[model samples]
Target: MNKKLIICALITFISLPNLADDETTLSGAELINNNCARCHNSRPVREFSISEWRVIMPHMREKAHLTGSEVKAILEFMEIASSPAQPVEVTLAKSLTVNPRDVLTRYGCQGCHQVQGAGGTLGPSLDNVISEKGRAFFLRKVKEPQFNNSSSAMPQMPITDDELEALAEFLSSI
Candidate 1:
């Protein structure tokens, strides 16, 4: 009996990782495609954070008539998708074609102020703003332009947190 117990413990220990990896399969993808996509087109899983998803799922659950378990599965998938450690450079590179300048254009940022010789002159040039203000400050400004400065003319950019982070990373590099 002692020998049998030892063998069983070893087998279970060895199989734990395999079980975890198997659990990570595209179950979330299927749930999103079958349930979430019924109402609207599929969205990129990494677009929103887990906390945002927690808030959003309840609203969507009622609309889609999803059960609690379905919401849990979708949240699990998004948590993995938007994990902080996921390399942002891969997505940024794919979109920009290795040119950070495209972010400004894509976000309509070029129409306001010049940064590397493109954009309107209504706002101050961002030649050294990144260096001066730091990335966190820059992100705050982008998210809430008129937060502190009442006279600030910049509009609140309608962008996801992921895009804002990518834009900030690109801006800081420039």
Candidate 2:
């Protein structure tokens, strides 16, 4: 019984660090989703460049009534999300298996754009934007958000081609 108790305690101790990490991650996403939507729609983490975010977060923190630690978590999440995309060599088979909705959530698309009667309102509702705009146009816009409008505020999303295709098709259907 004493040996079992020791092993259990050791296992719990080993898991504590991971539990903290999980809590922080969940809180960061949850804080943004819950708090930001109270007054205005939540912006996507990739909406601003890191430098831009550095300048913007303080003001937003005050406006959003976020604590320092809350802001830190959000900033960390933003920094991770805004980093340049690493090239991923996705095979055709892998691409075929990609879930479009997961891609959208991973990239925080719904933070700015509404889809299927849910999501934020910072950007246009995407329920029919893809169908209204051709798939080629949607693809170009996401790849280079400023392709047509040099002054557009939309950030270039760090997404793979497979993910983009999947998202486009998914959005088009909605």
Candidate 3:
């Protein structure tokens, strides 16, 4: 009777389905594709400042209706992706030098400032900033963002001199 009981117990245990460790966490790419890709491109696998990523990811998540875990996984994957030290390639896709058009879109400057017939209207028009302000004025305005309009709703832009020069040249060319 003991042997039979032991045999029955073993059979019951063997027939039971696994209850633990059945599921694995999703990969970042998978999470992004499943959630974010529906609305926007999975954030460019480029070196994004933590603030930049943080600023953008929430919007993407909100649009996609993704859960917190899904957002976290996608961000983790983006952080692991090998991107350039600077946003050089993304800025230089059109040419070796900066493309003003590209810069406007990449930084979402278009969302606020108007370029040569493009971009948003929340801020002043930059249609002729290249010609009107010139390089010196442009530099000052960009550097001292609060000089002209202390109450300007625009956020202080943080970019390097090289990027500034490239952007200026591109704008001037346009």
Candidate 4:
């Protein structure tokens, strides 16, 4: 009986798509097609962040019989796919845990400040700042606008210190 059970178990394990010899580095679309499509139809992968996916993947993993490697590959694929596609801001090889342009858009910087010779006329254009000034100047201006210029009309942004640094870095590149 034990011999029979072992043979059956091996057969079942071999049948599972999550077996070690199966495809390991699946892309986001491939993962969805193979694992997620087993139960539900296509759903928007961009609807959730990687963190939210982390919270939700466990429930689906058990249901789908996904291995740990499969779950990790899928999560990475989704994170990269959902990230804003910008040459300077992102590359698929690097996980997009920190996208500066996303932060800039979130803070509505382009509403007033201009970059690359295009933006609202409300604030001064930042196109020349990188060439004329430096990163230090850019950082100070973003973190504490009034410090850079006492007569500056730009308001001090409510962004966190890291966000301010990222914004400064992005602007400096522009």
TM-score of each: 0.42, 0.46, 0.43, 0.41
lDDT of 2 by residue, 1-174 (tens): 556556766666664434356666667777778887676686667776888877887898988899988987777766655665544332234444689989979988889888888899888888888778788988999999998899987888789988888888778777
Task: Kindly list the per-residue Cα lDDT of model 3 for residues 75-127, writing each as its tens digit.
Answer: 66565454333321122232454555666666678898887777798877776
The stretch of ten residues in a row with the least summed lDDT in candidate 1 is 86-95
Model 4's alpha-carbon lDDT is 0.70
User: lDDT, candidate 1, residue 112?
Assistant: 85
Residue-level lDDT tens digits of model 4 in 28-105: 457779879777777777788778999998778888888877788788767766776433221221213346777767
* Shift of residue 64 alpha carbon in model 4, Å: 38
Kindly give the stretch of ten consecutive residues in candidate 4 with the minimal lDDT sum: 87-96
Candidate 3 minimal-lDDT segment of 10 residues: 85-94
**Candidates 1 and 2: which is better by TM-score?**
2
Candidate 2 lDDT score relative to the true structure: 0.77
Q: Mind giving the per-residue lDDT tens digits that candidate 1 earns over 1-174?
A: 556556766766664433246453356657789888876677776667678889999899988888887777778767766655422222223343334455677778878888877778888767667889777788889899998798998998777676776666676776
Predicted structure 1, TM vs. truth: 0.42
Flag clash pairs in model 3.
Answer: none
lDDT value for candidate 1?
A: 0.71
Better of 1 and 3 by TM-score: 3
